[model samples]
Target: MKTSQSYTESGYTHGHSAPVLAAHATRSAATSAGYLLPELEPGMSLLDIGCGPGTVTLDLAERVRPGRVVGVDPSLEALEAARDEASRRGDRTTDFMAADVAELPFADASFDVVHAHQVLQHLQDPVGALRGMARVSASLVAVRDVEYRTMSWYPDIPGLDKWLDTYRAIARANAAEPDAGRHLKSWARAAGLEDLQVTASTWCYTDPESVHWWSGSQAARVSGQTFARQAVEIGRSRADVEEMRRAWLDWGASPDAYFAMVHTELLARVPARR
Candidate 1:
């Protein structure tokens, strides 16, 4: 099958209805992952940066139902989508703000728990963005991201490794972080964030029986298509492009399709006395 035919047209750009992308986005927004938000209290303020579709925003609201939660992003589409979702959930305490993370409009020290997930990897000045989030943040800041370099690869396919490299090269050309886990910590520390800690994890694609495979397939396909597109634009031979695409596709089907990637949880404090 043609790579395009096998992959969704949106290919995880921003708005795609692919099952894989939807699942991954949903997981990022879940409240179960809110452990990093230590500043969250019954009546404390919370902010979600790049709050795509307001998943994390809603999650934050649940933590501080009586308190206020704000979700901010530059994309009106994302803000509207998040609003629509909030409306469906009847989450009145949560509000969506259309703004840039790099330049927030909020007053300094306004929020207790400022949370941003999967947003830093795409930024030009990730450190600057972290500083912006840290500035408006009251006491605590937490950001989560993946390390593409540590992305687990178990298949013994010879060509697959080369394809991975090619795919990564193309991704960087588009001004996106090909590997963001290690960079997340550096950015946080450079932003003058103290008490920084990094927690790493690996989400794998197990055999067909593995419940995560359903979601992993979407990620693999989206990432694979991204590589394929870059390969075409970068003048890689069509055969080489197809080889990489196929490896990624087969990765999803293989019983041993387990990839380990690094993740981080960065924290800092803003003194109330200061």
Candidate 2:
């Protein structure tokens, strides 16, 4: 609700990831599969890195009933939104804090499960963050990230390439790394994590309409958070943005349209019991 859509120095101004994740199928996967917390049982502690809007935290807390869940995020806006939702749910077991993922305040081996989704791709030092999570978790460290640099497409949609370029440019303009997804497994392994397991997942939207629509929708959502902080001169237009969005969706929904969405994650056990 900030009046100006000017791009900010932070690149990603709003906590848009939370919303996108909340609406997408990935959250459902977490809800059903426990998001790689297989060894976990009730009363175990859980930590969510970059916990936007608290949806995953609250839901996981519910899953592991009578257990405490802590959601940590760096964005005050995301924390505020999460706090409001937690209060409304009257979930006393769920709590959120404003904190950096790389420098968690919790004690060593404090949690049983430490989970992060689509987080490392935004980090400049993903290995450091994983090390932090490894230090804090007593059992497991799970990380899910998308390789943004691997995002590819076919057919020439007007403005499609520009959108990706601007998006990557804005992301790199900030202190963030835009290609974080390229080697998530390597980073997790490099973080001193052994017994590592990695999985590759893909979401193919062949609806032609919905697949492209999904892309456009994603583009619009990301650009708003990524580019809105710029001055008016550098700000993207709503109309142009909408056009790209429509094109994307139209492409997705078209008969010739095909989409391959790739995401990867790593699950590792704590190497040492401190």
Candidate 3:
């Protein structure tokens, strides 16, 4: 079951397949940025790390109009998708590049604000990535990540627990923390960031439109996404994965179905130059 690629070192355990990228493309700045949006100002350079599909990155470009904005990720395909999105939006201000979080290619203090959304959870060395971010940020660093263990759904369907357990196992096997929300502050401290401000938020899907969208996305992910393949690699059978997919669909169909996921957000100030 060993593939040539090592998922542990890839940082993104959930490989950027089509379904995953589609899920990411649904995220918008208002929904994903949390507390970071209020901090943006015109004429401030911004960098978004692991900026998948550039949906949020384009929103940021609008916010920091007349300023520099760049989105960076390790996947060239993701970057290409992001570039296409920028083109579709007719946005010429934003730029997308392929770069690693642990070793950003930009010079030190290159940006006024650096942000990452749902990025740290996938990294085996999140603190190392933060250090690199801190190096490039002149004024601030903002991040938000989910605590997957705190995810909850009502009217749970059969095999839902198994699905959660399998996902946790796969993430651990990749040396990534599935529940990264609780560790943002500690990781920030380890990265030597100062003047920290931390907050919590929740993304709740209860309305029919939201629930159906979220559930359908998860169903596809568990059925054919990289995580599903990794689950089999870790000993879960294909039948089990299919059951999980059905469970997601069943949950989506329930009359009283609801889902909520908790996230932690933080804004830390990078120390001024000596």
Evaluate residue 234 in candidate 1 and report its C-alpha lDDT on the 0 to 100 scale: 68
Global lDDT for candidate 1?
Answer: 0.66
- Per-residue error for 262 in candidate 1, Å, reads 1.7
Give the candidate number with the greatest TM-score.
Answer: 3
Who is ahead in TM-score, 2 or 3? 3
What does candidate 2's lDDT look like per residue over 161-221, in tens digits? 6666655665554445566655877887788788988877765666645564566656556
How far out, in Å, is residue 231 in model 1?
A: 3.9
Q: How accurate is candidate 3 locally (lDDT)?
A: 0.87
Which residue segments of model 2 deviate by more than 4 Å?
1-26, 29-37, 87-90, 152-156, 207-216, 222-225, 228-246, 249-258
Least lDDT summed over 10 consecutive residues: which range in candidate 2? Answer: 1-10
lDDT of 3 by residue, 118-172 (tens): 8888777888889988999999999999998998989966688889898888878
lDDT (C-alpha, whole model) for all candidates: 0.66, 0.67, 0.87
| TM-score of predicted structure 2 | 0.77
Q: Which consecutive 10 residues in model 1 have the weakest lDDT in total? A: 1-10
Model 3 alpha-carbon drift over 4 Å, by segment: 1-11
Which runs in model 1 stand beyond 4 Å of their true positions? Answer: 1-21, 28-34, 37-39, 158-163, 207-229, 237-241
Q: In candidate 1, which residue pairs clash? A: 152-259, 152-260
